[model samples]
Each structure stands twice: as C-alpha cells, then as structure tokens.
Target: MDVDVLIVGAGPTGLALGIDLARRGVDALVVERGETLAPGSRGKGLQPRTLEVYEDLGVLDEILAAGGAYPVGMIWTDGEQVGRHAMFDPAEDGEEGSRFTGPWMVPQWRNQEILLARLRELGGTVAFGREVVRIGQNAEGVTAHFASGAPVRARYAVAADGGRSAVRRALGIPMAGETLDPDRALVADVRIPELERTWWHVFPPSGPDSGFLALCPLAGTDQFQLVARLSAGAEPDLSPEGVRKLVAERTHLAPEAVTELLWASDFRPRAALADRLREGRVFLAGDAAHVHSPAGGQGLNTSVQDAYNLGWKLGAVLGGRAPEALLDTYEEERRPVAEHVLGLSTAILRAEARRGAATRQLGLNYRHSSLSEETRRDPGPLSAGDRVPDLTVDGVRLFDRLKGPDWTLLTLDSGVFLVRPDGYVGWAGDTEDGLGTYRARVGLG
Candidate 1:
C-alpha cells in the first residue's frame, strides 16, 4: 500500500485526522485540492469539546494564543444601542471540570493553519493540488485517481472533501437531509474602520423583505465576519460595492467604515447526512458525511470529532493491534451522533431550539454504542461511553494522562475504568475480569 490511509481535503477535519494518525505512528497522507489552506473565517467558533481534543493533540497553546472568548453581542436599532445579548448560555467556570469556559473565537483559516503545523510537527504529509476525481476499491485496498497525478493506492481512503464530495458520489454513497434554510446567506470577512472589536454587532430584520445582519469581530484578527440573511429569492452580491452598500443600508454603519473585503461567498443553509458513513474500504468524514446549518456552530466541531473518533481505530487496525471489524464502530458511533447534531443545528437555525445546553455539545454521549461495555454493577457520575471529565489526580491533570495515542486505565473507588484513546470510558467494571477480553476485542492487546 502506498500509505496506510489517504485523507482527501485539508480542512480542519482532514488536518485533524492527519495529526491524530501521525501522532499514533500511522503512515497517512492528507491531500488538498486547493493550493493552500482554506481562506476566510468560515468555521470560526471552536466548541469547548473541540478545544479539549486540540489540547490532546498538542496544539492547544497555539490555538489559545491565537483566539479569544466569544464577546457579548450588541444589538442596534435605528443606529441606537438597544441591548447586549449573550451569544450562548454562559458556561460557568470549570464546567464539567474542563479548563476552557466556552467556545473560542478563531478564524477557520487560522485554525487550519495551526492544525497543519501540528501535523507537520508530527511528521505527517500533505500533498496540495492533488484532487481525487475518481476512486476504485477492491477487497485489498482503494486506489484514488487524481486530477493529474498518478493513482494513489492505500489500504483505506477517507472523504473529508466537503458537502459536494466527489469521493462519496464516486462511491455512490447518498446523503439524505432537507434544506434547513432556503434563504441565501452572504458571509464575508472585512475590516471595519474604528469599529468596536469587543462586541458582536447585530441588526434585526426591519421590514417584510429585510432579514437579520450580524457582524462579529473575528478574535485575533482585524477582520469581522459579516453574516446577512437575504430574502428567499434574493441573490447575494459578493462584490466589494455590494457588501459595503448592504452594510450601509442595513445598519447604522457608513459605507466608508467597511475598509476591505477579504473574502466573500453565499450559500443556503441545509442539513444532510450520508445514508451510510462507510462503503467498503472508503469512509466518509466531516462535511462529506454530514452538513449542518451554522446556527449552533456544530458543523465544524462535529466534523473534527468525526476525525477524533476514527483516528485511533484506524491506527489500531492498521498497526495489527486490532481486527478489521473494530473499524465498523466508526460508523455505528458517529452516524447517530451526526444525525442528532443535524437535528440540533437545524432546530437552532429555525429558532425552534434555544442556543444553550444542546449547542454546547457537552451532553453528547455514546453509552448505547456496542463498543461501550459497562460491567460495573453501579457507576457514579461517569459511565461507560461517557467522556472522562477532567480531574486533578496527584496534581496531574486527567487530560495530560489521556494525551497521546493510548487507552488509559483509571482506578477509583467505583472500580477500574478503561478509557478509550478518544477519551470516552470504553469499559467499566469492579475488577479486571473483562479487561483482557475487551482489549483483545479492540486489538489493544
């Protein structure tokens, strides 16, 4: 095999998977169709759970240095300061024993750059301008035919290619979901002159045809992410003049306050989940597997988690530590999560759901997963398939111990617990009766 795995696309999802695999000593290659990292602040808000994942991946320091907390939103009406609104239900200090209080505000471009640096630091490879146009897989492995380069053969392939996934289509995998919002949203990044960077400015819909417009100052950068909801049949003008005019007419800001239009695009919000996440030797991840409305900022976080969940399993099977069947758990565990998150983000997009507890994503768990086995008679606050919350045992943080690519065994008064490489409690029991069996089943032995 040319490599253990071939990852298509180099966004946060693909780069994150590459980092996870590289740290596990798994030979993997990440290929991006674009010449460089994605531009703009597409997925700027990083959920707290994703921050925990980044801490484990050894890039948390950089991420923290480059980002800040979400600022309170300032609402304006008729050029008057109406009120300040909270973006999310405030996550209290030490919520669930995590160090991060809430979501961090970092531009998606900056986040991808940090992940790429970490991937390279771990000796991973990323080949740019190699877009996979066709793919063919057999019993042994999969071969990806790129736009120009020779075919790449690997034991397995992953699709992180985004909503319009060429790999998923080539493999005949179907994504089925409804459009959450039919209105076209114009998203752009621009520098505003003398605008307060401490608050996310909001302007509510004024008339029957008008819609909401929000400009959030992207933390750690001078740019602000402008989100304008247009009418159902209205086409978004992405040019400089169009953006400036929209801002001046929609809000109190003068046209000249908008200094630069770095990048701009328009898309209708929709939610979709692949009919199946896996097809033979190829697996779908990130936008390739599911798409969500950006209302709750769940899309990017969920996508990163898809990588985190699959990385260790792939390494185990490929490293000869576990049987190939262990890989099946990827679909079983993530598909349900994807479905739930799709519903969640859509609900928030439609205003049917509040952007508080559910949007935080801390409540998500996989207790029903087949891979999760709770052998203990009665568990305490934690259980099999629950995320292992942070704890300071003997002054060593739980996350510090859980870092790297290995399962951790934590023995407490409750019993002995086996934590999966992805930080979930895989097995819990009063003793080690089924520990050996569990290890053998997952190829950990």
Candidate 2:
C-alpha cells in the first residue's frame, strides 16, 4: 500500500483531515490539483462550532493569532445586535469544557495555511499539482491512478475533492439534490470607502431584492473584500464602470470611492448531497459529499466538519482498532445534518427572495440522537443536542476538554459516557453499568 490513507484535494477539508490523521500517527498522503495553495478568500467567517473543532485540533490559538476576532453577530434589519450566543467562553458563563467563546472572521486561505503547516510539522505534506485520474478498489485495498500514470495504493481512500469531484464520479456515486438556479452572484475583493470598522454588512444600499452585500475587512482600511449577490441578469463585465455601477447600486458609493478591483468571478448557490457518503472502501467528504447555499457561511464549515467526522474513524479502522461498521456511521451522522442545513439555507434564500426580514443563521441540533434523548425536550432556543452547550465541568471546560484528536467522553458527573472523535457520544448508559461493554463498542477498550 502507498500509505494507510490517501486524501484527494488539499483545501480546508482535505488539510484538516490530514492534520488529524497525521496526529494519530496514521500514514496519510493528501493530493491536490493546484500547484500552489489557494490564496484568495472564498470563505471568510468561521462559525463558533468550526472554531471549536479547530480548538480541538490544537490550533485555535494559532488561528486566532493569524486572523482577527469579531465578537458581534448579525446586525438585525431593525439594527438590533445579536451576539453569537457564547458557546465556548468561560468568563461570560463559566461553562466548563468551553474553548471557543465566539465566532471568528478569518480568510479561508489563512485557515488552510494553518492546517497545511500543521500537517507538514507532523511529517506529512500534501502533494500539490497531482490530481487523481481514477481509482479502483478490492477487498485488500484501494488504488488511485494519477494523471502521470502512476498508481498509488492505500488501505482506504477518502475523496475530499471539491463539489465537482473526479474521485466521486470514478466511484460512480450519484449526487442527489438541487443545482444552481438561474441567478448569478459575483464575488470580488476590492478597496472600499471607510473599511476596517465593521466585519460584515448584510443590508445592501440597493435594497433587499437586489441581494445583500458582505464586506470583509482585510489587513488594512485600504484593502477589503466585497462580496455582493448581484442579479442573475447582470452583464458579465469587469470594466471599471461595470463594477462601479454594481457597487453604486448596492452601497451608493461614488465611482472613485470604489478604488481598486482585485478579483471578480460569478457563481450560483447549489444544494446537493451524494446518494451515499461511502461506497465500499472509498469515502467522500467536504463538497464531495454535499453542497449548499453560502448564505450562512456553512459551506466550508460543513465540509470541515465532514472531514472531522471521518478522519478518526478512518484512522481507527485502518489501525485495526475499529470495525468497518464504525465508518458507516459517518454518513448516518453527517448526511442528515447536511440535508437539514441545506434546507435551512434554501429557506433563508427563499425568504430573502421575498425581501423578508429574518436573521439568517444555521443552528445544528442533534435532537434525533440517543445522547440528546436525555434532555427529552424539543431543542427550543438551546438544548443538549445543540452542539453540546459549552459549560464548565469541575474547572475543565468542554472546549478545553477538546485539547486533542481523541474521544472526549464528557459526562454530567463523569458517568462513563463514550464520545467519538467527531464529538458524538457513542454510548452513555451509566458508570456502574457495564463500562467495559460500552468501551468495547466505542473501540476504547
């Protein structure tokens, strides 16, 4: 076998999963089609839940140091401020096991850099410019054929490739769901007038039907990224006047005030999920498994979460410590979550289409799981299944408890609960009630 695991694509999802696999001492290799790591800012905001995952990977401090912090949430249509509802801060509520207290605003490229550096520090490097042409699998292992006519074998394979995944297609997996609508949205990084004071502005100067604008403050006031949702019918022209007119209609800015235009491209919102996240020994993650509207900034976050869910399971199974059935749970757990999240984003878009005034956000609540059953109440406002409320536990906070890439096993009073690496409780009966059996089931024995 070429390695224990082969990861295709070196974007956020691929790199994050590579970091986890390397930390677990798993022999892994990541392949990317791009020769150089992407530098542009496709995704800018890191949700609280994703920040918590980065904290667990032992890189949150580095991430914060590299990126700026934004504590405030959405500025409502009525101009009311809605905070991020502190999920990982100890000073505010003193919740144990909480690490990331709020959401963060960091360019997606920076986050990928951190993950890539961590992977290299752990003695693993992503092989860029080397795309996989095809893949074949059998009972022994899986083999990936490269564009250079070289075949690499591994015990298992994971397709972290982007939305248009060649690996997924080679495996003949059907991606079932919606595609981009007729509307076309343009994203461009530019120098706007009076920047760096605010992180994001949803209400556009052009009005709601004209689509909202997202202003991302970069390193200085002179530099910023302005992502606006333009009409699908907007002519595709990068001329100064063309760009100026769009910005003017949205922000009422003067032509010269727009200053410089860096990069401009058009894309549409799409919602899709693979018929199945796994087929035999090859598994799919990130955009390969699902795609959705970028309204809630959950696209990249969801992909990273997908990688987080699959990484440790792949490690455990390859290391002979876990049954293959454990790998099946990845789809069982994340597919439903993706479906729910995509549906919510679609609803938000529909609402936005009608110029409705609703604070758009994606809330993840696992009320369907067994561990969440303990609460026994609908996840109204807040509940146990809702990202496991960050609370203080005997001075060791929940976020702090996620200091490494290992099972957490958090209990109300240390009652022998079993947690998976992805932060899901596998078994949570009682401390005195067959701990060994539960441990065996969780591969912790």
Candidate 3:
C-alpha cells in the first residue's frame, strides 16, 4: 500500500483527519486538486463544539490567536444607520461548561492553513494537484486513480473533496437534498477603506421582491466579506467594478470607496446529504457526506467534527489495536447528526428557528449508537455517548487529563467513566465490572 490511509482532499476535514492520524503514527496522505490551499473567508464561524475539537488537536492557541468575536450587526436604511442587531443569541447561564460559550470568527482559509501547518508539524504529507479520477475497493484494500499521478493504494480511503465530490460521483452515491432559496447569492472578500470595521453593516431590502446586502469585517484581516442576495434570474457579476457598483448602490459608500476585490463567488443556498457515508473500504466525510446552507454556520463545523470522529477510529484499526468493525460506527454516528444539522441549517435560513444551544452543537450525543454502554442501573445527568464536560477534578482540569490520543479512564465520586479519544463517554459504570468487556470490544484490552 502506498499509505495506510488515502485522504482525497486537503480542506479542513481532510487536513484535520491527517493531523489526527499523523499524531497516532498512521501513514496517511492527503491529496488536493488545487495547487494551493483554498482562499477566501468562506464559512468563517467556528462553533463552540469545534473549538473544543481544535483544543484536543493542539491548535486551539493558534485558532484563538487568529480570530475574533462576531461584531454587532448595524442595520442601515436610506444610507443611514437605523438600529443595532445582535448577530447571535447570548449563551445561557449553565452552557458555560466548556471554555467557549459562543462561535469564534476565523476565516475558513485561515482555519485550513492552521490545520495544514499542524499536520505538517506532526510529519503528515499532503500531495497537491493530485485529483482523483476513480476509486475501487476490495477485501484487502482500496485503490484510487488520479487525473495525472500514479494511482494510490491504501488500507482505506476517504472522500473529503467538496459538495460536488468527484469521488462520490465515481462511487455512484446519490446525494439527496433540496434548494432552500431560489435567488442566487454572491459572496466576496473586499477592502472598503471608507467602511468602519466595528460592525457587520446590514442593508435590508428597500422594497418587496428586492434583496438584502451585508458587509462583515473579517476577524483577522482587513478585508470585509460582502454577501448580497440577488433577485430571481439576476445575473451575478463577480468583477471588481461590478461588486463596487453593487455596494455603492446598496449603501452610502461610493464605488471608489471599494479599494480592492480579493475574491468572490456565487451560489444558491441548499441542503443535502449523501445516501450513505460508507461503501466498503471507501468513506465519505465533510461536504461529500452532507451539505448545508451557510446561514447557521453549521456546515464547516460539522465537517471538521466528522474528521475528528473518524480520525481515531482509523488510527486504532490501522494500528491493529481495534477491530475493523469499529469503522462501521462512523457512518452510523455521523449520518443522523448530519441529517439533523442539515434540517437546522435549512430552518435557520428560512427563519423557522433561532440559533441557540442547538447551533453550538455541544449537546450532540451518540446514545443510540451500539458503542455507548450504560451499565449503571440508574444513570445521572451525564450518560454514555454524551460529551464529558471539562471539570476541575482535584485541581486538575479534566480536559488536561484527556489531552492525548488514548482513551481515558476517568473516575469520579459518582462513578467510573471511559472517555473516547473524541471526548465522548463510551462506557460508564459504578465499578469496573462491565468496563473490561467494553474495553475488549473497543480494543483497549
């Protein structure tokens, strides 16, 4: 095999997975079609749950240093400031269990750059301009053919390319989804010298059937991300002059005030999920497994967590520490969560619900999975499959104890809990009676 695992993308999902596998001494290769890392401030919001994942991956310090909080939304009408709007609902009182209570604003490009650097620090390899043309799997392993380079063979393969995944098409996996908006939307990163950076400037639609525009200052850069909804059938011009004219028409800023257009793209909001996450030795993750509207900021966060969930399982199996059947749980655990989050993203786009604790994704659990074992006759507030909170156990932070890639045996006054590498409780019992069985099943024995 060319490598133990072949990751077919170098975005956040693939790079994050490569980092996890690299740290575990797994020989994994991440291949990207693009010559360089993707650019633009796409999918900038990192949810609280994803922040914890970054902490575990050892990049939390860099992530926190590279980003800032979301600015307050300033409503504008007739080129005049009208009101101030809170972009996110404040965190509830008890939701402060984790260090992060709200989403952090880091441009997606910077996020991937950080992950890529960490992967390299762990001695991981990413091959660029190696696009996959086809993928074939057998009982022994999987082989992937690329557009230019020699085909790669590995024990397993993952498709993390993007929403329109070439690997998914080669595998013939049908993606089921619906369009959430008929009007097209344009997103761009621009430099507007005249605009103040303190607020996410918003311009509501002037009349019925018109569209809205918003300019948000990117957290770690001087560029502002411009989002403008277009009327149905309106052609989107991504040229710098076109973007400047649009901004000038929508807001008080003059066309010349738009100093530069760094990057721009257009898309229609939609939600989608692949029919299945795994087919034999090949697995799907990130936008390959599911797609979401960018409204609620769930797409990128969910994609990164997908990598976090799959990384350790891949490592365990490749190292001969866990049974191959452990791989099956990835789809079983992530698909449902993806489905639910897709609905949430669509609802948030349609204004059917408010962004609250659910969007934080801290409450996501895997209690229904076969891996979760609750031996205690009476379980407490914390149960199997739930995330183990970060508490100070005897002056030592629980997260500090659970830092490495190994499963932790956390003993509290109430009971004994086995924490998975992903920070979820796998087994909980009053004593170690059933712990042995659980350990043996997961290869901890």
Quote each prediction's TM-score: 0.98, 0.83, 0.98
Ranking by TM-score: 3, 1, 2
Model 3 Cα lDDT, one tens digit per residue, 1-445: 9899999999899999999999999999999999999999999999999999999899999999999999999999998899999878868544657877789999989999999999999999899999899899999999999889899999999999999999999999999999888889999999998789999999999887778999999998998999999877899999999999889888888999999999999999989999999999999999999999998799999999999999999999999999999999999999999999999988888899788788999999999988999999888989999998877878999999998799999999879999999999999999989898899998988
Better structure of 1 and 2 per lDDT: 1
Say which prediction, candidate 2 or candidate 3, comes out ahead on TM-score.
Answer: 3
List, residue by residue over 273-304, the lDDT tens digit for candidate 2. 88998888898998999887766566788888
Global local distance difference test of model 1: 0.91
lDDT (Cα, tens digit) per residue for candidate 1, span 177-269: 887677889999999968899899999988888988999999898889999999658988999999999999889989889989999999889
Estimate candidate 2's alpha-carbon lDDT, on a 0 to 1 scale. Answer: 0.70
lDDT, candidates in the order shown: 0.91, 0.70, 0.92
Of 2 and 3, the candidate ahead on lDDT is 3
Q: Clashes in each model (backbone N, CA, C under 3 Å)?
A: 2, 14, 0
